[model samples]
Target: MIRSIIKNQECFSIVQGLPEPGQDHNLVWLEVHTPTVEEGTILQQRFGIETAKKNSNVVEDGQFLYMRSRLLALDDNGAPHFGGVTFALGEQLVAIICDDANFQSFDIALQRLRRKPANGQSPKAIMRSLLQIANDRADELVDQIAEELEKRAEDISEISDGYNANGMELGVPDLIETMRALNAKEELIALCIETQLSLARTVRYLSSEIDSTNEADLQGLVNELAFDVAGVKEHAYFEHQKVQYLQKSVTNILNIKQNQIVKVFTIITAVFLPPTLVGTFYGMNFAVMPELSWEHGFVYSMGLTLSAAVLPLIYIKRKGWLR
Candidate 1:
């Protein structure tokens, strides 16, 4: 499953093969993309590359250790040039490996390289080119994330306003979920920033040893990465503000609703108090109750009850409480 791209003398070519290491071919690039150590070993055998034997055997700090080495030297401009070998004999690689999201971009670049015949490019040059392409792909991903964030912020703002207008209640769970989503998006933006920063640093390192043509291409890729990082940061800030504002709005709405409930309870109590007092007085069943002996007592009591109820209603109305 190893995919190797070799650019020799301005020509780009790709080779898909198993991993094997011992040949001294100046233009050979070996990449291993196997899921298991056993599979990687088989690939290594097929390619004749030296596999880390004991270096791949032991566990270190509760995890398997994969030993990797790269050559470092000073370039003509006195800048450090790093070119290396990578071995994934460890659990970290296994655990961290994911389905490559950028595989489509890689495939497209490889197809372009294949269509144009390689004149005489070296393997190192080809690797640099591939790295540049990968950096560009990362930038594209960042841009896509930024766009999504912007759209989400807009949608959420609209939803918040609609909820406010409808007098609908948003529960704690809904608010919490919204906050969680915002936090996740913020984390992703941070990750994109980190990724672009790493690529930019690599570009600086590669520019020293890589030829002028590739260097210019890599620099352009670096600039794009920088721009992507900046955009992501800006969008992240906007999203943060939007999320904060929405949360505050929800809090205010909940508070208003609480106050409304209290006011309703108060009005109901005030309206019923007078009727309750009259009912209590009549309920005192004394045999000598003077009102009970009167022929017009029932009408008088009814009038009294009506007056008690109506007076509060009129007063509350005048004070605007009913509104």
Candidate 2:
């Protein structure tokens, strides 16, 4: 799908013709959505873009190579920012590529550009406009991530409190899974920060290379990108702290559990010590055993066994060991 946004157009106007560099030697803005190598080739033939760029666009592995190349080119130019931005030109039109397909802000900006006086707008102005739109979308995404992190943190806090209050035990697997989730969130936050920083640098390069037609909007976008980076950093910090707290909590729970097991074993050993001693004495089978010679000796032995078992249990209870 190829969509063209003329200056001051509010919505993307899809056209059937492939995006080609216009012959007018003026800046034109277009977005191409090609999902296959064939579609990309068609777009390249129509737009007059280099074959390499077209090949880059046709990546079948879904690795986002186009975005990566844009980042790399920006970096090489000393802008080195992450995120998506593309620029192409012909004799009549210059096109800026933005990945945001459904963002309302970009639509509105495109509309306003259409209404702007055409005598003064340049390709650089169009590029800045696109950059601002991309940055605004990124800011929105960062805000959403922040909200999600807050909600997750609240959930984790509640679960932690419940465990503390009820003496609940989490198995090793559950603890490990929770830790893995925290790590994944942290990595995502870092990626967002890197991308935002790269975008900021791209904005800076655009500012230096272009004329002052849309500098205010470009600078505003840079500020917003910086703010987004800060937000991601803060979220990452919070996630790290949560992970540490969870680790400590799990360690403490395991220690308490171990102590309980040790207590049970100690009680068992204390209760059986006397019976073991009595059994050992009666098991002697020598001729010198008086209990074997008398009929009532067996009854005495049974009484002794009963007393041996019950007495230690009573002692342990009196000492509050059973509790």
Give the clash count for each candidate: 12, 14
Q: Against the hidden true structure, what lDDT does model 1 obtain?
A: 0.49
Worst 10 residues of 2 by lDDT: 63-72
Instruction: State the lDDT of candidate 2 residue by residue for 1-323, as single tens digits.
Output: 45554433232343443433452222255555332567567655665543234444222223111222132122223222233445553334545443433222344456656565342255555555655555555455455545656655554554544453356754444445555665655565565555555665555554454334646664554455456545554654555565556556655655655676788998888777888899998887777988878989989988898898899889989998876
Best by TM-score: 2
For each candidate, what TM-score against the reference? 0.53, 0.55
User: What lDDT tens digits, residue by residue, belong to model 1 across residues 114-232?
Assistant: 66444123333344444445555544545555566566555455454545345665544554565566676556545544544444444444344445575565445445544554554
lDDT of 2 at 227: 64
Error of 2 at 321 (Å): 12
In model 1, the runs with Cα more than 4 Å from the true position are 5-35, 39-217, 321-323
**Model 2 Cα displacement at 53 (Å)?**
5.1
lDDT of 2: 0.52
